[model samples]
Target: MSTERPRIVIAGGGLAGLSLSLALKQALGDAIEVAMCDPALKRDPHGDKRAYAIAASARRMLETLHIWDAVADKAQPIRDMVITDSRLQDPVRPTFLTFAGEVEEGEPFAHMVAGGDLTAALVESCRNAGVALMPTSVETFSAHPGGIDVVTNGGGITLRACLLVAADGARSRLREQAGISWISWPYRQSAIVATILHARDHEGRAVEHFLPAGPFAILPLKPETLPDGRIQHRSSIVWTERSEEVPHLLDAHTEDLLDELERRFGLQLGELSFETKPQAFPLSFGVARRFTAERLALLGDAAHVIHPIAGQGLNLGLHDAAALAEIVVEALRLGRDPGSADVLDDYERARRADITAMGLMTDGLNRLFSNDALPVRLVRDLGLGLVDRMPGLKKFFIREAAGLAGGTAPRLLRGEAL
Candidate 1:
C-alpha cells in the first residue's frame, strides 16, 4: 500500500484559510498533508482593529478545534440587540426591532471578537497542529490533469498539491485565474470602522441605528480596567456613509470626525474617545458564478462578499470553510480523490443555496434601507415593525442569526465529531 498522504494547499491565511487548516488537522490528523502560505507571516496581527460577531455555529466549530479558549477573555457575548430607524437629524430614533440573542438560557447567540485576536489564535493553533505554514506569497499556479503546481514569489519554490483552495480576499488572483465569473456591484456606500473607549458600560448590548445614509452599529467589546479599579468600556463601530463622502469623513481632523460620530452615537454611552484611527472600506455585494473550478475551490471572500449591514459576511465565509473541510475529509476517508469532480460538485451544491440566499438578502436590505426616499423608508420601517411583532418569526430570525436556520446542521456546528 502506498504510504503517501494526499496533499492540499490553501492560499491566503486569513480567517477562512486558517480555520479550514485547523479543521482538517483535527479531523484527518496525519492521514492528510496540508500546507498554507501567505505573505503576511512577518506582520503583527494586532494592527487589525476590526472585530467580528461570531455566530453560535462558528463558535461551536472553533470550540471543537480548541481555539475559542485563547480568545474568550477578549470576546464579549452579545446578550441583546436593538434596532432603530429614523432620519439622520430626526428628534427621535425610534426602536423598530429588538432581539434577545440567546438561543438557549445562559448562552449568547453570538460573540464579538477582534479580528487581530482571532487571527492570532488561528495562526498559533495552525502552528501547533503541524500544518506547514509557508511565509511566501503565491506568485502563480497552473492546474494540470490531476494536480496543481504552485510557485511562491519570494523563493520561487514550486510545490504540488492534489487540491488548491483560495481563501484570498475579495480580489482573488487564483479565482480570476480559474476563470470563475463574479456578479458584483458597488453600493455607492462605504463604512467607517473604529474602536472607541466610552464612559458607561455596554452591558453586552449591541445597537444598530438605521439612518438615511446606512446602518450604524455599535458592538460592545470586553471591558478594560485601570489600575485604580475603574472599568473602561469600549465598542466597535461600523458606520456607513455615502461613498462620495467617505474620503472627506476619513480625512477630516480627529475632533471633526468625532463631532460627526457624536451626532449618530447619541449620549447613551457618555463621552467617547478613539482607540484607533478610523478606517473606511467601500461596500459591495458579490458572488462567484460557481464556487469550484477544476481542482480548485473558492472560500470566504473569494466565493462571496456581502454588505456589513447584516454582520454575516465573515460567518458566511466560516460556513464555507466548515463545509469544504467536511466534504474533503469525507472524500479522503472513502479513498477517493478529494478534488475529484464528484467531491467538488458536492461541496458546491452544499454551499450554493445558502450563499446565494444570503447574498440576495443582504443586497435587498442595503437597497431597502440605505436611502432617504420617503416611500421606501416608510415601507421598510413598517416591515421592521411587522417582523418585530411576530414572536415565532422573530425566534426564527434569531436562529438564522445563530447560524442554525437551514437543514441538517454541520457536525462541527452541532459541536459533534465528524
Candidate 2:
C-alpha cells in the first residue's frame, strides 16, 4: 500500500466544513488527510442559541459519521408541523395545512437541534478523528496544476492541499478569489432569532405562522437544566420582518416585543421569555456560477443560500458535503486525483438540479405568502388546504422533507458504511 495521501483543506469551519471533514475522514480513512480553517469556530466553540432543523436524511449522515449519538440526547424530534396564514393582529390564524413528520413507526422526519450543541459534538468528533482543526482563516490561496497553496494570514502560514473546499459562507472571499461569480439578491427582509423559555410543553410540535411580514416559526427544542436542576421547556423562534422594520423591532423594548411575539405565537405554549438577546440575520438568495473551479470546490453557503421559509439552508449544505465526500472518496479508490476537473464536474452535475429546485421553491413560497393581496392569499390558502386533504401528496412531501426523495444521495444517508 502507498504511504502517500492526498490532502483536502476546507475553509470556514461551520457546519458544512465540519461535516465534510468528518465525512472525508470516514470515507477515506488513512488514505487522505483533512484540515479545516475558521477562527470564529475556535473563538466560540460553544455555539449560539439558534437551532437547526436536521432532516431525516441528514440525521442518517450524522449517524454514519458517529455524530448523532453524541448529540441525540439534546435533539428534539418534530412530531408534527402546522402552517397558517394570517395577519399579526388577526383574531384567529386558522391552520390551513399540517404535516405528520414520520418516515417509519417511530422515526420523525426531522429534528430541532441547538446550534451550540451540534457544533460542540462535531468539533469533538473531528478532534477524535485526528482531523487538523486550524484556528485561522484562509486569507488567500493560489491554484496550480497539481495542487493549491493556501496562506492563512498574509503569507504567514502556508499549506498545500490537493483540494480546497470553500465553505466560507455566502460572501465567500475564497469564492471571490477563485473568480467564481455568484448571483446574489437581498430579500428585503430579515429574521430575528432567539430562544425562549415557555410555560408549557410543546408536545414536539412545530408551527409556522405566515403573516404579511413573513414567516414566524416556533421550533421545539429540548428542555434545559438550570443550575438548580430544574427542567424548563424551550423553543427557538425565527421571526421574519421587512428589512426596513428590523431596526425598530430589534431596538424595541423587551416587553413590547414579547407582546408582539405573543400575538403571533398564541397562548398555546403559555408565557414566553427570551432566554437570550435576539439576533437579526438579513435574508438573501445566492448561487455560485460554478460549484468547482480548478482545484477548488464550493460547499454550503459558499455555493448557495435561500430564504429561511423552509428552514433547509443548513440541510442543503450538509447534503452538498455528503455528495462531495462520496465523489472524492470514489475517485481516490480509483487512483484518480480528488480535485480533478472530471471529479468536480460529476459533483456539480449531481447537485445542480437539487439546489436549483430548492432555491426556486423557497423563493416562490416567500413571494406567495409575504403579501396581503386577497387573490394571491386566497389561492395559496386553497392550495395549502388542498395539499392538507390529500394524504398521498402529503406523504410525498413528507418524504421529501425527510430527505428521502432525491438523486445523488450518499451512502451515509442510506444508513450504510462509507
Candidate 3:
C-alpha cells in the first residue's frame, strides 16, 4: 500500500456522513484523517419524528461500523412482507398478490429501525471507531482542484483529500455551494409517521397496502433499546397521504387517527392504536444534476432523494457510502488521489446505473399509485399477482429490494455473520 493517506472531510453528521467517518477509519486504520460536521448531534432533532426500514443490506453496513450490535435490539427483522391492493368496501379481503420468502435459508432482506435509535447507534459507532465528529454545521463549502475548504461556526477546517463527500442530505447546502443543480418533482403528498401498538403480533412481518391516495407501510417494532440497555416491544407506522389532506389528518384526535388508519390498514394485525401523535413530512423526488463536480462528490439524499414508497431512503445512501469508501480505499492503495477526476468517475459509474434505476422505479410507482385510474390499478394489481406466482422472480425482487445484488458488495452487507 502507498505510504500516503488522504485527509477526508465529510459534511452532515447523519447516517451517511457519520457512516463514512467510521468506514474510512476502519479501512485506513491510522493512515487517513477523517472529520465530519453536522448540526446538533444524534437524534436531538428539533424536527419531527421519522424512521426507516433497514434492509439486511444496510444492517450489514452498520455492522461494519460496529453500530448494529448497539441498536440491533431495536430492529425487527422482516421475516416476510405481505403486500396488497385494498379497496374501501372490500377492506377485509386485500388481494395478496405478492409475498416475500421467509424460508430461503439465511435471512430476510431487511429489518425495521426507528430513526432515533439508528442515529444514536451511528453516533456511538463514530465515537468508538475514533472518527472525529465536529459538533458543528457547515457554514459553507468551496471545492478547488485539489480539495475543499469547509467553514463551520466552531472554526474553519480545511481538509485536503482525494474527494469531498456531500452527504449533508436532500437540501444539502454543500451541493448548492458547489453549483450543483438538482432535478426535483413535487409529490403532492406527505407521509405521516408514528408509533403504534397492535393487539396482535406482527410476527416480524411488514405490511404494505396500496390505497388510492398512496402506500401505507406498517413495520414491526421488535423491541426497545433503552438508554439503560434494557429491551422492550415496539413498532412504528408510516402512512402517506395527499398534501392538503395531511393537516386534517394530523388535526384528528388519537382515536380518529386510529380509525382512519384502520380503515385503510384493514384488520390485518387487529386493534391498532396510536402510541404517538402523527408527524407529517412533505414527499418529493430530487436528484442532483451531477453526482460529482471537480473534487466534490455527493452521496445519499444529497445525491438523490426519491419517494419513500419502497423505504430505501437510508439504504440507498448507505450503499452509496459503502461504494465510495471501497473506491477510495482501492484508489489510495494504487497511489492515486482519492478525489482525482478518474477515481471519481469510476465511483459514479459503479453506482449510477443502480441508483438511477431505483429512483425511476420509485418515482414511477408513486405517480402510478397516487390516483385511482382504473386502468393503472388494474395493471399494477395484475403485476403484483404475477410476481406472487413467479417464485423465481420473487426471489430476485427480494434480493434486489434487500440490497444484496451487488458483486463488489461491501464487507458487512455480505451478511458474513457480522
Best by TM-score: 1
- Where in model 3 is the C-alpha error above 4 Å? 1-5, 42-49, 101-104, 157-162, 223-233, 406-412, 415-418
Structural similarity to truth (TM-score) of each candidate: 0.98, 0.97, 0.91
Residues 1-418 of candidate 3: C-alpha lDDT, one tens digit per residue: 2355567778787777777777888887777888787766633632334657888777777776678887777567887888877655663655665556342476767877667777776777677777777777767666677566666767665544556788888998878988989999888889988888766677787788787778888787775456998644456777888899998988888788778888876675667776677788899999887898777789899999989999888888888888888888888767888878898898888778878889999998888777687887788878888888998888888887888764667655664321
Candidate 3 global CA lDDT score: 0.77
Poorly placed runs, candidate 1 (over 4 Å)? 1-3
Alpha-carbon shift of residue 207 in model 3 (angstroms): 1.1
lDDT of 2 by residue, 36-120 (tens): 9888765676756679999999999899998999889999999999999998878988999999979877989999998888888
Q: Is candidate 2 or 3 superior in TM-score?
A: 2
Against the true structure, candidate 1 reaches a TM-score of: 0.98
Q: What's the lDDT for candidate 1?
A: 0.89
Mark the 10 consecutive residues where model 2 has the least summed lDDT. Answer: 40-49
Worst 10 residues of 3 by lDDT: 42-51
lDDT of each: 0.89, 0.89, 0.77
